[model samples]
Target: MAKVAIVMGSDSDMPIMKKAAEFLDQMGIDFEMTIISAHREPDIFFEWAKGAKDRGVKVIIAGAGKAAHLPGMCAALFPMPVIGIPMKTSDLGGVDSLYSIVQMPSGIPVATVAINGGLNAGILAAKILATSDEKLLEKLEAYSEEMKQSVVEKAEKLDKVGYKDYE
Candidate 1:
């Protein structure tokens, strides 16, 4: 049973949404991914969103560009946490998509991240799930330590090599 549902409006979002999947994989979180356009196929999307909870999906990470209704629609139908990733668009540089997800009406809230922020979305989803699972919480803590160590290693190299020699 998947705890997270990773959905996007189109395949073009694969590049961005893959980051979320990669992070979830590292955290040992199971997720079901699919491309479902809320506008083009409302019936299918609606059914999927409504049945997500029954299917064991506790969180949803939705990526969409342009109008970006996928995330908001999922939030509206699914009674769980929804994290929206606004893909960068060539037209407005994803401002349109960002606004659409963030400006959701009262009583319906979609937690949105920056344009193309799939990794953060995945981390946020993991944090939400970790509230009830001690093992997952420990994994999250170790992940944070790993990230901190990576930065420390980079900083040490930069200090030793100096800015000119660092690459």
Candidate 2:
């Protein structure tokens, strides 16, 4: 099975990046993680992305804060899908990162999640992979249904107890 690569620009992003890793682990999806800054180490980023396909990486989840270019750069270098998770930083509160990731040029598209949306990135990658694998597609469908059921169950319980009484 081709695994996912979880790359972050800095160690500070680990806390946010870990959420994606945890989600992938829960889904039984293999993933590898590393810290590589696009601005500081462009060569390393290019090499890693170029070699990702041969290394059996089907998808990449990249997280970065200000001026986030990791995901866009990877998308340009690799043909595989790239999911961008914008991390919240002090300066721009992640708006800069969000725009950097979402505004990709023609021919290269990077799917971007909300700020600090690591979990969603992981789930999106799984959905992409499920397009080809029947078993994974089934699992993804079941997961979505389970989430719906959980929300419905919570509403039912709230109705039975009444919100005022619970409070």
Candidate 3:
């Protein structure tokens, strides 16, 4: 059973949504990814949102552009954390989507990440799940240490090759 559900408004959002899938995969987290446009496929979207809890989805990563109603709607229907990844649109460069997802009603709140922030959404989901799962919590801690180590290694390498003589 998947712990996370990655939903997008269209397949065109795949390039952005895939980052969430990749992060979940790295953590050995099972996830289901699909397209369900709130505007074009309201019934299917509603069904997915309503059934997500029964389907074992602890967290939902919803990526959508334009009006970006998917995340907020999911928040309303699903009684779990919904992280919104607003894709960069050609018109407003995702400000419209960001605002739409972030400005949910007082009762319904969607955790909105930055525009095109799929990986952050995935990490946030893992962090939320880790609060209950000890194994996942350990994995998250190790992941954090690895990130710290990676940055230290990068800083060392940069010291070896200063910007003036970077080649």
Task: Give the alpha-carbon lDDT of every model.
Answer: 0.97, 0.90, 0.93
**Model 1 misplaced regions, further than 4 Å:** none
State the lDDT at 83 in candidate 1. Answer: 98
Better of 2 and 3 by TM-score: 3
Candidate 1 clashes: the total is: 0
- Ranked by TM-score, the better of candidates 1 and 3 is 1
Colliding pairs, model 1:
none
Models ranked on TM-score? 1, 3, 2
Please say which candidate is ahead in lDDT: 1 or 2.
1
What would the per-residue lDDT of candidate 2 be over residues 1-167, giving only the tens digit for each residue?
A: 45899999999998888988987887888888999988898888889889998989999999988888899998998899999999897998999999999999999999999999988998999998888889888888889999999999989989999998753
Which number leads on TM-score? Answer: 1
User: Can you tell me which runs of candidate 3 are displaced by over 4 Å?
Assistant: none
The per-prediction CA RMSD against the true structure, in angstroms, equals: 0.6, 1.4, 1.0
Q: Which pairs clash (backbone N, Cα, C closer than 3 Å) in model 3?
A: none
Encode model 3's per-residue lDDT on 1-167: one tens digit a residue. Answer: 98999999999999889998999999999999999989998999999899999999999999999989999999999998999999999999999999999999899989989999989999999999999899999999999999999999888888999977755
lDDT of 1 at 93: 99
Best model number under lDDT? 1
Model 1 C-alpha lDDT per residue in residues 71-166, reported as the tens digit of each score: 999999999999999999999999999999999999999999999999999999999999999999999999999999999999999999999999
